[model samples]
Target: MKISAVVVTFNRKKLLLECLNALRNQTYPLDAIFIIDGPSTDGTPEALLECGYIKELPPKKGNWSWETKNVIYSPINNKPIKVYYVRLYKDVGGSGGFYEGVKRAYEEGYNWIWLMDDDAEPREDALEKLIRYMNLPGVIALAPTVIRPTGEISKPHRGILCFKKIFPMIQIPLDESKYKSNQPVQIDFVSFVGPLIKRDAIKIVGFPKKEFFIHHDDVEYSIRLRTVGKIYLIPDSVIIHKENIKKTSLIKKRFLGKTIYRIPYNKLWKTYYGTRNLTYLGRIYSKSKFKFYFKLLKRWAVSVGAIILFDDHKIKRIQFITSAYLDGLRGKFDNEKPKRILYGGKKE
Candidate 1:
C-alpha cells in the first residue's frame, strides 16, 4: 500500500533536520514525505535546501497560498523517495499545517498518511511496526508510543478521554502494564505525533479543524475519528518527542490537607488558544445546553480565581482569559485577538 508521511514544523530548524534524517532511515520506506513549514523565520526554508531536502525554496504566492516544491531523494541502493516541501506565507499553526498536509497527501491518492510534528523522530522500525497491523479488521489508525529523550513514555499523547463524570473530563493514559504488553491497546485518543491513519478514515471524519489554530485540535479530531472505526496504540512502534521544555514553576500553598497549586503563565497566547479551543469543544460535545453554559461559567470562575490568586499580570491574564472564554462560547475562531495579546498590541 502507498503511504505518505506528513511532518508539520515551525521555527525548530535543528530538531526538524533530525526528524527528517530519522524518516530517511526508516526500515519501511515511505512513498513520499510532505514537509509543511509554518512560515518559520529562523532560516528553516534555507536549511531544508542546504540539507538537500528540497532543491529550491518556492517563491511566496500570497498569505493563504502555500507554495510547494518537489524533489526526489535517491539513496545509493535504496528506492528514491518523493519529497514535497510546502512553505506557507502565513503561520497556520499545527492544526492548519496538518489539515493542508493531509489534504495534499490524500488528494494525491495515498492509501495511508503517517502524521507527525518536526519535533518527533520515529525509531527506524516505527513505520514498519505500524504497517504490520494495517490490514487488521476495523482499525482506522495506529500510532507509536511517544517517548522522551530519556526513554520514558510521554503519557499525554496516547490515552482515553473519559466522560465518566459530567462536570469534569479525565484523560487516563496507557499504564506501564499496557505499554509492556505485546497486544495492541484500543484507545480513544492519539496525538498527531506518529499516527498512521487510513485514507478511508480521513474520507469519513475529514481533516483536523484548521480553525482550532493550535491546541487540542488532535483531541477534537480523535473524537470524530473514534466514531467511524478503532484507533489503536501499537506498543512496539516508538517515536521520540523532542518538544522544547517550557520553563515554568507552580505557585502552591497548603490548604486543608492538600496542596493547592496554580500553573504560572509561560506563554499567555498558548493559554488563550487552549482555553478558547477547549471551551469550544465543550460547547459542541455537550448534549445539554444548560450544562455547557454551566461548565463554561465554572471554567471562567476557576481561571479568574487562579489569575487573581497566583499569577502575575492580573489584568492582562484576566482580560485574555475572559475574552477567550467568551469567544469560545460564541463559537468564534479568531487569530488576531490572540496574537495581539501575545505580542504587544492593544486588545481589539
Candidate 2:
C-alpha cells in the first residue's frame, strides 16, 4: 500500500519539527509526507528546509501555495525515505488543510492517508498496526489511542454518538478494559489525529467539510463515513496528543456538577464556531424538526445564562454566540475573525 502522512501546522515550529521527526522514525514505511503549513511567520518554512534532523534534501521547485520539498530520513530498515512537504498560503485551519491534503493524496494515487496534527507524535509501531486492520471486512478508517504528553489517555476512536436529548455530540470514556489487545474494534467516531483512512472512503463519503472550519469537522466527516463503512480503533496503535495536554474548556456546572467558569472574550470565537457547527450537525441529525428547534432554544437559554453568570464581557459573548446561531441557521461559515490577545481588559 502507498501510505502518505499529512500533517497540518500553524506557528508551532518547535513541536512541528518533533512531530516530523517522529513520523520519520515510524516502523512502517511511508511513501510520502504531505505537510499543510498555514503560512507560519515563525520561519517554519525555512526551518523545514534547514531542519537539523534530516540532511541535504533540498527544494527543487518554485514556491507556491503547495510548495514541494524533498526530505531525506533513514529508517531502521536501512533505506532513505523521501517525504513531500506542501505549504499552504492561506490559513484554513485544521479542517481545510485535511480537505486539501486528503484530496491531493487521493489524486496522487495514495491508497491510504494518515492524518495528524503538528503536535501529534505517533509511536513507532502506530502505522504498522493501523495498516493491519485496513483489509478487514467492513473496516473503513482506523486510528490510534490518543494519550496526553503526561501519559493521561483518551480514546478518540471509540465514542457514543447522540442527537436525542440535546445537540449532536459525543460521549467518551477511555476504558482500558474495552481495549484489551491490538485487535480492531469498531467505533462510532475518531479524530483525524493519527488516523489512517482509506482513500476509497474519501472517494465515497468525500473529504471533510472545510466549511465547518475546525472544531467538529472530524465528527461531521466521521458521521458521513458511517453511511458507507466501519471505522476501527486499533488498540496497540498509539499517538501522543502533545498540544492540548491538561487543557480545559468552558464547562457549565449543570452538566457535571463542575463549577461554572469564566470564559475570556477572545475564546468566544471558538464558541462561535463550535456552537454554529454543532447546531448545524444537530439540525441535520436531530430526530425531528420540532425536537431540533426545542433543543436549540434550550441550548441558547442555558448558554446565555452561563455567560451572564460566570463569564466576562457578557454582552459580547451573547452577541458572538447569537451571531453564530443565526449563521448556523442560515448555513453560513468562514474564517470569522483573527484572534486578538487580551490582557486586563486591554487588547494586545
Candidate 3:
C-alpha cells in the first residue's frame, strides 16, 4: 500500500528530529513522509534547510494554502525514501496542521496515512505491526501502544462520554501477549499520538474539525470515526511518547462500571479548549438541545469556578472559555485562519 506518514510539529525542533529519526528507521517501507510544520521561531526552518532537502512538489497554482514543496530522504536498506515537508504560513495549532497533512495525503493518492505528533517516536516495527491489521474487515484505523521514555505506558484514552457526562479516562495496558498475531480489538476512542489511518475512512468521515485548534480534537474525531469502522490497538506496535509528564488526578469509581477522574487541566489553554470542546460536543451528540443546554451551563459554570480557583490568570482564562462556550453554543467555526489568541500562543 502507498503509506504516507504525516507528522504535525510546532516549535520543538529537537523533539521533531527525534520523531523523524524514529520514523526514518522504521522496519516497514515508507512511501512518503510529511512534516506539517507550524511556524517555529526556534530555528526549525533553519534546521530543515541544514538537513539538506530538495523541493519535489511545488505549491498548487492559484491556491492560498500552505506550501508542500520540500523533500527529505530516508534510506532504508540501501534505498532512499521521499519525505515531504509542509510548512504552514503560521501556527494554526495541531488540529489545523493534521487537517492539512491528512487532507494532502488523501488527495495525493495515498492508500493509507500514518499519523502522529512530532513528540512521539515509534518502535522500528510499529508501522509494520499496524499495517498487519489494516486489511482486516471493519478496521479503519490502528494505533500503537504509547509509552513514556521511562517505559511506563502512556494514556490510551478509550472513554465513552455520552452516558456519564465527563468521565475519568480509562487506560489499558499494552499487553504483548494479546498481540501474538494481528488481532483486532474494538475501541471507543484512541488518541492521535501514533495511528495508521485508512484514506477510505477519511473519505467517509470527512476531515477533522480544525476549529478545535487543540485539545479534544482527537476525541471528537474518534467519535466521528467510530461511525464508519472500529479503531484497533496493536500492542506490538509501540511508540515512545517523549512528552511532558502527564499529571494524574483522583480516580473515583462510579456505578455501572464507570469512573469519574479528576484529570488536571494543564493550563488556561487546556481549560479553554476542553470546556469549549465539551460544550460544543454535548450539542452535537445530544438528542435534545433542552437537555444539552442544562449540561452546558453546568459545565461552563464549573469551568469558570475552576479557572477562578486554579488559574494564575483567572480572569483571562474565564474570558477565553466564555468565548469558546458562546461560539460552540452558536455552532460557529472559522478555521481558515484562527483569530490571534491572547495567551499561550498555539498548542500541539
Candidate 4:
C-alpha cells in the first residue's frame, strides 16, 4: 500500500521534531509525509528546513481565514521517499488539520493516509504493523495502542457507550506479556493520533467535521466512519504519547482547587466536546433508538453541572455548555468558535 503520513503541528517545535524523527525511522516506507502547520510563530519553519524532512508553505499576510498549502519533500536515502508539508495560515485546530490532510491524501491518489499528532511518536514498526492489518476485510481505519506517559496503555474499554447509550465496542484484547499484539475487537471510538485510514473510507464517510475544533472530533469521525466501515484498534502497533499530566499547585489548589479537578490534559476539551457533540449526534440517531435521547439528557446534565459547579472559568464554561446545548437543540452546527481560556476567571 502506498501510505501518506499526515502530521499536524502547532507551537510545539520540540515535540514536532521528535515526531518527525520517529516517522523517519518507520519500517514501512511512506510514500509521502505531509505536515500541516498552524501558522506557528515559534521558528518551526526554520526548524523544518533544518531537519530537511519538511518543506515550508507560503505565508499569508492578512485575513483570519485558514489557508491550505502543501510542501513536498523526498527522503535523503538512496531510494528516496516522497514527503509533503501542508501549512495553514490560521489556527484551525486538530479537526481542520486532519480534514485537510485527509483531503490531500485522497486528492493525491494515495491508498491510505496515516493521520498523526505532533506529540505522538510511533514505534519503528508501527506503520508496518498497521498496514499488515489494513488488508483485513471491512477495516476502514486502524488505530494503534496508545501508551500514556505513565507507562500504562490507554486502551478503551469494550462496549462503552457514546452519549451514555450502549453501542458496539471494538475491544482489542491486551496481552500482558507483549506490549503489542494484533486482534480484531469492537470499539465505539479511537484516537486520531495514530490511525491509518483507507482512501475509500475518507471518500465514503468524509473527513472530520471542522466545527468540533479539538475535542470529540475523533469520536465524531469514528462514529461516522463506523456507519460505512469498521474501525480496528491494532494491538501490535504502538505509539508513545508524550503528554505530561500537569500537577495542580497547592497554593492555587487552596483557592479554586475545589472547582478545578485533575483530568488528562488531552481529555479536558474532550469532556466538553464529547458531551456537546454527543448531544448533537444523539439527535441525528434519535429515531434509530429511543435510548439515544435519554443518553443525550444524561450527557447534557453532566456537562451543565461540570460547567456550573466544577469548571474554573464558570462563566465561559457555562456559556460554552449553554451554547452547545442551545445549538444542539436548534440543530445549528457550523463553525462555532469556542470562548478562549475556559478555565481561568477574574478574581472578585
lDDT tens digits, residues 1-348, model 2? 788888888899888999888888888878778888766778787787687433333333434575565656656675555566666766677888888888888888898889998998998888988887778898788978888878867664456566664364543544666677647777777887788888888889888898887888888888888888898878778898886533265544453666555555655565567878887777677667798888788878888887787777777677666777777787878554424212233422
Tens digits of per-residue lDDT, candidate 4, 1-348, equal 578888888888999999887887787767777788766778787787777765443454545433333333334343456666665777677888887888877888899988888988998889888887777888888887788767687654212334444322122334443334347554556778788888888888888888766655776787788887887777768898887546552122223445445443223444455445555666665445566656556755776775554445566566766666666556565443333334332211
Ranking by TM-score: 1, 2, 3, 4
- RMSD versus native structure for model 2: 4.3
Considering every candidate listed, which one attains the maximal lDDT? 1
Tens digit of per-residue lDDT, candidate 1, span 163-185 = 43223443567677789879788
lDDT of 2 at 200: 83
282-335: candidate 3 lDDT, tens digit per residue? 666766677567767776788677556444556665666678778767777644
Q: TM per model?
A: 0.89, 0.86, 0.79, 0.77
Ranking by lDDT: 1, 2, 3, 4
Please report, in order, the local distance difference test score of every candidate based on alpha carbons. Answer: 0.83, 0.75, 0.71, 0.67
Residue pair clashes in candidate 3: 168-261
Question: How many clashing residue pairs, candidate 1?
Answer: 0
Distance (Å) between predicted and true CA of 64, model 4? Answer: 7.6
- State the local distance difference test value for candidate 3: 0.71
Off by over 4 Å in 1: 74-77, 164-170, 248-266, 287-295, 310-313, 341-348
